[model samples]
Target: MSTVFASPSENGQTSGATGGASTSAASTPRRSAVAAVTNRLASPQTINFVDVPAQEYYSTNVFTKSVMKDRLPKSVYKSLVRTIDSGEKLDPEIADIVASAIKDWAMEKGATHYAHIFYPLTGATAEKHDSFLSPTADGSTLSEFSGKQLCQGEPDGSSFPSGGIRVTSQARGYTIWDVTSPAYILENPNGTTLCIPTAFVSWTGEALDKKTPVLRSMQALNKHAQRVLKVFGHTDGAFVASTAGPEQEYFLIDRNFYYARPDLLNAGRTLFGAKPPKGQEFDDHYFGAIPERVLAFMCEAERELFKLGIPVKTRHNEVAPGQFEVAPVFESANVAADHQQQMMLTLRKIAEKYGMACLLHEKPFAGVNGSGKHVNWSLGSSSQGNLLDPGDTPHDNAKFLVFCAAIIRAVYKHQDLMRAVVASAGNDHRLGANEAPPAIISIFLGDQLTDIFEQIKGGGANSSLPSGTLEVGVDVLPPLPKDAGDRNRTSPFAFTGNRFEFRAVGSNQSISGPLVAMNTIIAESVDFCAGRLEDALANDPDSLNSAVQSLLSEIVGECSAIIFNGDGYSEEWHREAAERGLLNLKTTADALPHLASPENTQMFAKYGVLSARELHSRLETYQEQYCMTVDVEANLAVNIARTMIFPAAIRYQNELASTCANLKVVGFEFDTETLDTVTALVKSLQDGIATLEYAIADDSAVAPEDACRHRCDAVLPSMLSLRETVDKLELIIADDIWPLPTYQEMLFIK
Candidate 1:
């Protein structure tokens, strides 16, 4: 009930938050936390999906290709299809027709405003909304959307985090509409906005946003993939595209508990809490029956997503209490990235209406499984089908092996780059823990594929790995397919039957960063394969099979160090991985500098995914974000501990001393055990708080590396040590007087 001190990490981030200056919560009308959590229908959201079949509502909000066909002129529709299907440039003359069709479709969906949405460097979505109204000479308005307005919009580059790309007095960043990602109406209770996904860039044409690099990388990948397909005798192929299906995991707690804890409100995590008496220890929470309240939220969330054309297919309980996951089916990389950002936004907003807060931080709590976004990715073309799949025919299988070999080569050569892409302050808390993958980047080929690759290294793969079925003894349960082997959850990157799952991405991050890196690296590797095979065909046309085998063997022989089929969580694997020369970057600070390394920058520049200047700008911006996050966490720890925990502990200490004195006067023996324990923890808490304050103040400069090193070495240890003391106090202190919500109440009450 007392005024909580500053939560300076995005302080005042949530509504009615207490800041550096104290403010009272006692006056606010808050029901008992226990009663508030149990009220299942406290914030009822009326959505009935039972009657509305998915077929009727799915993609109804989007300006689908079907709608385009119905409205667009035949020539215009055909031109648009060529651009969408083949990655060809949109014909400028057809822009007016396309714009008019999209406007009509969106207007029919009840959209009055349109937004050019772009993903900027701040790791968040950006949008500038404009009314569809144009003033008439008679002072009335008419709905209008011009080809120029639909194609490009100007947003101030200097206002955003462009690193050094934009200086003062420069306000020129262009958001060019990306035709590949179709426009959709984003639904809001008040109104709907027509959202056009676009690529953001500086005036000089540098890639200034996340979407731009991803688009460029996709183009690079398609060009290189085409070169390889040409060598395989597919003269005319549809443009190949890497696809992504990001499985988002998150935790949801009641709104009362979420707002009560300043740490949770501003930082997206509980900075302080004792380990609960019960946790995910029993493993009962994993795949457990969904809580009724949570099930309703999921149902509504998925229904909203379906309307927007996001194909969410699975929803289930995850490994920790209150943790859950939702996975969408795969889509082209750019669309997937855009949908992923939308999905995060939708999940958080919908949770609020259901009276819960969706926690997307990688590690929202301690001593439990954290969250990760497992990105299932693959590359293929409509003409060639999925190149990663081991097809039924021998020739198809051989082509698959070549593409698979390219991925292996890419991962092995650029392990550091892979690690660097997923690096973030929130993720550093989860990686290398038992719940998530280790920092060392490696490939899991499964048993069957591993055997084939081993045989390729020996000489050639003479046969295919046969698939089998699992025979359950019970007659009621049907046989299950024995997949290429059981999946290795600990592997950072694992190749499933048809795609590789990048499990290192944090739950809160956009999938764009990882997809860009994956597409670019694989693009370079495919180019390498095509050059070698092209030379072989030039020399001897009849020896095509021999050339393919030779290329696979060469890749396997050299890049075998990256292929690990064992338990990736084992201590033995860490030592073995080190011996194998894989780079194990344990922290975001350690990994981010690699983004600006000459090799990485050169690769980005070579593929036209990003210029050197663009790459450097990204590196600078991300490093700044990393350092800022650490500094914020450190400061919050010091402020919360000194102001909240220390005072509460002292009050209890006073009460204990008074009780012992009063009992002595009443002629009774007072057991000093409780008193002594509280006294010692309070003193230790004070000492720890002091240590953290000193650490934070000492290294307050802006140098990215030193600042980060100080955080990792000094501030983080002090914060952890302080948390240990505070957590002990939490166990001993009276519940009525404790300042923050307990983990048990936050994690289990609902």
Candidate 2:
């Protein structure tokens, strides 16, 4: 056996040597790689299953209402519940009692340190830890947690990405306790820490994080929803809240592969790799049997989440190999957003223990199904459950139509805003691909709902489709009752029974942005409907039902363009959508600018969701993020192609040249076809690398939007060209000499 020398790069590609005769030198890395795979496969994890019942383990570390009631005085507990339930201002006097109870509960859970965790503008969770130990005068330590410390914490804001909100001189920021989101104890093998959920803000009191906007949007939504419900004769004072159930999708690859791939390590994606022959084309991976190793990882991760009060409900194989999904039951939008972040952190942490790395990138692998966080959202109050649910009666159905009409109007008027919320360089690769939803933000009200809306537009919706049953061919199978509507997987926004699933949200993104946009736009539409309905009622008090029907009719007729039940991914639908005057903001560069449009500015300002300054800052930040992401990926492509791939190709070419020369010298004719092909590809690769290098060297300072445009126009195309040549080379290169892990190895080996 010939020894193969492999000099892999940071991203796991052999950069130095291609082929060598010394077996020991070449076999070292090869032996390591093979050993990694063998060890992982043979030594499966053995999780020690705890004997405790699930109900007892659930929410054990959380400071739940039950815990609060048990720890705090009756008066304090009642006061806190009032504030939580009614969304009223918290009473400062009760903070001491609440803080003491929370501290006691956390201490009982074996926590000695506490941290105020906040969601910052970087689309990630941020925290600053503090010890509970306070030194006494005699040098003894006392564990003390004050009310002021529990309510607020000052962290240096200059380090975080504030979008220029905080200057160097003004580096102060505060994390204020969000009572709605419960505090929980984060347990590690070494110790446990009390994690308090909070909202981050700058010194100027501007909204500096995602949670602030989400909370404000929820308030704005509740006000409008309450007004509409009041007009419909519902006088209950319960707070209306938006609910979310985000289905998180991710990929799990062995840690050895992750550490070797520089592109995956730095950019969260593969910059270069030939498409695998056995991709997701056959659709065999979707909902298939879970690999034993992956199931064990999922079980341990779920157990950790359960203790933290995250109600994770479903886990299964996704459409692509190595990809999977986990969904949780619905909760209030604020709490669900927090739990979604926690779930992502937990998955990544637990995967490490299982010797795997969890990938949350939107398109971790090319030519396969990408990941998306389908944010299932709905609005309701304690009094009127699930405002979007259409009950079995005519009156209930009419009420549902009114609320649904509000969503239709919201989507029609603010499709650009919806597209802007999910805009990111990573997500741009997934959206409009065959695997995910199209970039055009259209609402999918299934067959039954579409018919009802059409009838309303004509004049009134007198009836709805009745539920049917499905009968299998075999007599042994039981009949399954059909749902009111069939799901349209291609639509970006689909009405899935009781909730509208925003399918375009990227897996790695925070749910707060999408929830804020959804709530605010729906609030605007609801307010519009309320004003019109009030006017119609004032004109003729006796015809309330007729007035409500007329209002819905007008809304349906105006916003009908956004309601598309057909194939959203089809060319015909694209053309028809354009004919209907809908905007298809395709890329992050194209969609992000819409965030600062005058209409969006006014909407955010009017609803108190975000100020004009904050909105513009966010747009700038995203544009900068997009430009940076593309620039890094482009640079990686050029480096890998020039240093790692080009050398290997040349070495192989040298081997072929020497072989051809020797054959001719020995009086034998040799075909030069292979040599000619390799030469031509090398030349093209050189040309592509030159173009990319030139594109990246233009270091002119410009506006953020202009920078993003340059990246999209020049840098991106050059990167793709370089990748095209390199991937082609990968297909032709010798297997043992190829420096990087093949798609087959990465995607299928596990």
Candidate 3:
């Protein structure tokens, strides 16, 4: 945390790598050897959590029937289990029994309080902690909870952002029981609390929360998926479910450094700083050794997540300095989203315990790799299972081919809608970047399947997927086998081994938005295919395979434009996509309006994913959110310029001018060139500020969209230019006068 600067000798050589007298005077007391060893042991290490026996992990890890069996009666336990697995309505009579069981289980785990956890439109989870205390008639107290309290909660809705759905005057909002997601105990520094996942809604109940729409979308998908499965000649089975494995990427900066930057604290990104002298250019940071501080945070985070029943599968260094990624195994979509939310909060709390701040911003630092949440999604049935799985005999698996073709068609036809799912003010900095996918949404089927789809289109037979060994070109390397195909990182939606990885979601966003769109779109396509096949079978009473083939053939033809097997980053692909009539929305403003488009409105309405009114309201909400974010950032830039940047520049200019004057008076010639350069730069910055100020004040004259565009695309660029000039001044100025922490200090601390 010390602002220690390197010193230089009179000969312009760096003073010997020893601490200067001034630096030594400023140093704090040294840590004990025991403390240092403790710090070293905190670094991340493999836990072999996945290798735990299934019987022990699955049976004892989570709140399963075995745990509930000892606490509740047979009837109540069965009812709760049915509700959790089958998505049935929660029976009010069973709430007290279930709550009591949960309370006992949590208390055994050292929990003293309970919280009703819910997801609001703020893009994060909200919870209110309350102690489980009930006063008795005597001088004693007994902890107790009633059926009504367990089933419902009334939290103050006035504080949460409602997107105009809930006005402040209407303070009534309800948190209804979402029995599908399991309740777990959150262990904190002070004490532990029972966290129950619930769906929040307003008095009017127009889907005022993220979880509500996700559940509704899941149901809509189930209805259509059931119809599709029925057409495939199946009945008397459980409903279809969607699964997601969201790979989370984030940055961990030392708490001392992060706290020093106002921009990081307020906006979750660095507003002004020159690029670091060394960045990710050499690509050495990827899979690099975990820094001691960051490693400790990750290890503790993983352990906590495991205890909460979140299966943390992978952890590694990412493509940039201070960037890291944590990926969990796939779970049902709703459960996965809930776990993701839980994981984020857990990461933050654990990071603080390690004296670090975990940044979930899409672009915390400019000129380095930005973070993205890769949503790996797929459909799985309760009985027949895995609709997207192309079996060993893929050509004969009519159901798989039909479902796969449905996803392609859905993505191709609704690329804009897909883009709309991940569009956000923060993510505008990531999409189309070197490390992130392009704004154009294209499906990467890999080389093997691209050829297969082409053959299917041309009425040709499927090719042999010959398995082969992959060898490294070095003698020391061992031979490795190759799979069906490789993935394309540049593609917005790429099909990995088992799931479609939607790579455009922002790090800070909830996975619910994108998965909802994906599930609904897939459901709609499946419904369309089912109706077609049912009609054909009824009319001809003949081959189901031929009927499915015809349906898939037509779908692939209509939506073939969205399929891209080559490099999506290449300019050639963009041009080809343009020619194929694909929609490429490069920014939040460009993509958000598509949410209310007639095509999207019709699709959602047909599938009952969202009503027309709800769709329009969401679009408006996003637009308003985008505008407000830009406004806040623009205002921050203005404040920094006026208070911090401008004053520092003027002080430096005065110092240079004084030095030149002193040299002239002392009968020695001094170059005034540096002084003149500083003067010119200051003038340019002043002019840029004036321009931004005028545009900001003219906001009343133009529309909100225009104003937002002016701020984001216009004023933002000008602000960057202004900062460039000021940053140059900082490099020349004395270190003592530089008020803000340098980029090196901010990025490299600890």
The digit string of per-residue lDDT tens for model 2 on 1-750 reads 111111223224332222122245444333345445544323433444655656778999899999888888998888888877778888889888888878888888788999999998789888889998899999899989989999999998777777888878899999999999999999988889999999998899987888999999999999988888878888787899999999999999766667667788789999899998899889888899987767878888998999999999999999998999999999999999999999999999888766678999999899898999999999898888998887764334656777888999999999999999999999999999988999999999887888787877787777778778886799999899988778899999999888899999999999999999999999999999888888887888777788788888888778898988888889998899999999999999899999889999999999999999888878877888888889889888888788778988998788889999999999999999888899999999999999999999975758888888888888888888888899999898776667676677777766
Ranking by lDDT: 1, 2, 3
Worst-scoring 10-residue span by lDDT in model 2: 1-10
TM-score of 2: 0.96
Best-fitting candidate, scored by TM-score: 2
Residue clash pairs of candidate 1: none
Off by over 4 Å in 1: 1-31, 39-45, 392-396, 700-702
Candidate 2: what lDDT? 0.86
Distance (Å) between predicted and true CA of 316, model 3?
0.6
The model with the greater TM-score, 2 or 3, is: 2
Which residue ranges in model 3 land beyond 4 Å of their true spot?
Answer: 1-62, 137-139, 473-479, 701-707
Model 2 pairs in collision: 4-26, 7-14, 7-15, 8-13, 8-14, 9-13, 11-260, 11-261, 11-262, 12-260
Candidate that scores best on lDDT: 1
Write down the lDDT of every candidate, Cα atoms only.
0.86, 0.86, 0.77
Clashes found in each candidate (C-alpha, N, C closer than 3 A)? 0, 10, 0
